[model samples]
Target chain A: MTSVEHSPLTRKLSAFVALTKAELAVLDRLHKRRRIFRAGHDMVHQGQSAQTAFILYEGWVCSYKLQADGTRQIVDVQVPGDFLGLRSVLLRTSDHSFEPIVDIEAVEVRASDLLEAFAQTPRLATAILWAASRDEAMVVEHLVGIGRRDADVRMAHFLLELGARLALVGMGRAEGFDCPLTQYHLADTLGLSAVHVNRTLRQLRERGLVTFRDGHVRFHDHQGLVDLAEFDPAYLDQTGPLLT
Target chain B: MTSVEHSPLTRKLSAFVALTKAELAVLDRLHKRRRIFRAGHDMVHQGQSAQTAFILYEGWVCSYKLQADGTRQIVDVQVPGDFLGLRSVLLRTSDHSFEPIVDIEAVEVRASDLLEAFAQTPRLATAILWAASRDEAMVVEHLVGIGRRDADVRMAHFLLELGARLALVGMGRAEGFDCPLTQYHLADTLGLSAVHVNRTLRQLRERGLVTFRDGHVRFHDHQGLVDLAEFDPAYLDQTGPLLT
Candidate 1:
């Protein structure tokens, strides 16, 4: 927590917003009470009333919604610098569950503390709002992929988007970075069957566009994947006033 | 525009956050520069760089993301009181398009004006942010429905949600409400084939759960449909802090 410059959250927000020194210090101050939850256990459940969220510092987590039919849809995957259960802080109950992909580090954030931060630094508040809007846009993009894009395009877009997001936080680059999502995870995310996900991954590998295998995503032809996925990172990196 | 007491935006946000008279006045003041938009035309197209949003005063509009393959996914169907393109004002370029379902009345909003309003009334700003969070939750719910729920449940949940949303605006009720969407729109929203949407509607009607026909949604067995859809509206109506 000492190296504010090394903070992925700071780096991500700073991409679009220039934070003042005091704002960076205030952001640094929010890193108290770091906690770790073991992988394979949900830290939050749907309908669980709460007013706390987490700022991920390491590892990966996913938010998912479970259905009455015993099936679950992975809504979003969280990485370092991402906020987990942020919407829950504003709403009475958490509408989804979060399961860590690995034993990870995070800082618990109270709603009051966040509001106090907003009061102290309006610019920081706007930057955080921009971050939230960016997260919402990513979900919207995912919804579009699920509703309209074919499996190939969907997989390609998902991977490329993740890569771009990670790059902003210094966790990944075009050649790719480590990944932990299994085929089942891909199935739940892409709205495809596990078999379908498996086939799609094989197809992408055959096409030499991207590869998601054994805890990594290696981009063979990043440009080719981008073209096929129609990937546009403008929403993620827009220089709109709030975004700035 | 004088009916501050009857403004649907006010009504919807007031359900979650009580607005003082001053907040209401500020909200009312945002309604200048009223304009009319025709149906069957896009006021906002995907990737358009802009800084203006609109507050819908009347009629329905749908936002959609088009794919390279000529197919489009209807992301959200907005009604009176909804802020169309609000997200676009934050992100430099809109990632989707907006098409009015009918001739509509709306007020234009610029980014700077909105920021000024937020600065004037922080509580009101929180309320509006609550509204945005509610919208994001709806999309997440739709993502879950499309990824995990069966066709019948998806359709039932979607219709019930729309009904609940419209009810807040005093435009709908428990028994039924007028709708302008076609089977094709349902297909896009639910990520199903149009034939599948048709079959599901027929099935629900035959089962006496609900009926969506000829531009209307009638709740034949409202409770039964809710049971079928497993609709828990906590996310939409949470009593959390920002909500208050």
Candidate 2:
């Protein structure tokens, strides 16, 4: 396997702990075996015993549960640098299905190998645990979005969150991010109908707060959006010192 | 500090990993300093620098975020053995407020002391991580409830979930559990109006599916309720081997 000079895992881990060269080498080796999946591919299915955890090297993946009424609720959106199945590694089964919204490049790390790595490298383990906690924080934030916020505020909050997460990996600018998700995905995520999502998007565009076109979202007034959504980035835990 | 015979923290940790007598002794010692909080008291407030984590030894607590519009979203319902502020310990601030739902007995473990414990006992650390992951899983499940399910299904699902969780700690019976939350809390949790929640509860009661009286819920048909909610316990991760 050809080694990449820099990986998103390295960038993400560095945010939690200053990885030594040796630590980086171990991460690089773990992520060397990359696999690509096309859009709409179910990378992991619910109830399946998950044996491997994937590191999203590129593109978007979403974890969602399909309800009895046939509607889906996306639990988490995975971007580059996100570990897809860290919790599954401990839980042993996938509680939700993971699928790619776009063509995705991911590196598969066997559960045994990851556990071994965690045992051998405490710093790396701390980073992984930090990542897991951050994921829980994000889920809680999203719960607030769906449970308390209205459609307009939910859309604003969702876009601002996506932009912030993307900016962490140097993918998006302060004002915008590449958003490949359609109105259907937004509907599922925000607990609104697709029609409602479309109307809300139009309202946001008319207000000059946000604009989505050509698979990208541009925030005309980032602060305006933030204010409308009551968005706070502190929950993301990005500004903290390295745990180690 | 008074030493107790057994603690919910020990029971919860033992589910994740087999605790040696020494580890159990440490946990018992950590939980010796019990604190009491009255109903409606905030255990940990949002935006506050959380210096400690609490183990819910008795009664109920909830972590919630208050919206700008004066509404609230209950992010998680904490039961006995639930670890609050584990994430806050890493993030340096509480992302959500934790409040007691009833007069509560809790063990306050300082964040620094918990970290020291983790450093000394990797097994204990792993158990905490498992607990965090379980919390995330519950949040994700609640997301699905609010995002996709109707009010009736949501209520059923919530009740069934509460029952299962309570049963884990030997609190609830097979058919029902003690439900101290009012319709207002249920409305907040399910993203419905209080009136709607009350009406739905009436409907469920009239249908002979469930009955709530004197702060206790009795399910006439557990399987019937589960079917309506499409509730699956696999997401709870109860069957997994302890992570020793």
Native interface contact recovery, model 1: 0.48
Sliding window of 10 residues with minimal summed lDDT for model 2 chain A? A1-10
- Give the poorly placed runs of model 1, Cα more than 4 Å off: A3-5, A238-244, B3-5, B238-244
Q: Indicate which candidate wins on TM-score.
A: 1
Model 2: which docking level applies?
A: medium
lDDT of 2 by residue, B1-244 (tens): 3554356666666666778776776676677577899999898899888757888889988888998888899887888888877777666678889989999998878755665565556566666767788788889988887777788998999899888878767788997888788877888788899899889989999988999778999999888898888888876666534565
Complex DockQ, candidate 2 = 0.54
For residues A1-244, write the lDDT of model 1, one tens digit per residue: 7756678788778875777888888798777769999999999999998788899999999999988888888988998988898788777788889999899898898877776776666666656666777888989988988877889999999998898888888899769999988888888888999999999999999999888888999999999999999888887864323444
lDDT at B93, model 2: 73
Instruction: Compute the lDDT of residue B33 as modeled in candidate 1.
Output: 72
**Candidate 2 off by > 4 Å:** A1-6, A20-26, A240-244, B1-6, B22-33, B240-244
Q: Write the per-residue lDDT of candidate 2 for residues A39-155, one digit (tens) a residue.
A: 997988888898678899999998898776677888888999998877676676788899999999998887566655655565666677677888888888888888777889988
Candidate 2 local Cα displacement, residue B24, angstroms: 3.3
Candidate 2 has an fnat equal to 0.51
lDDT score for residue B108 of model 1? 91
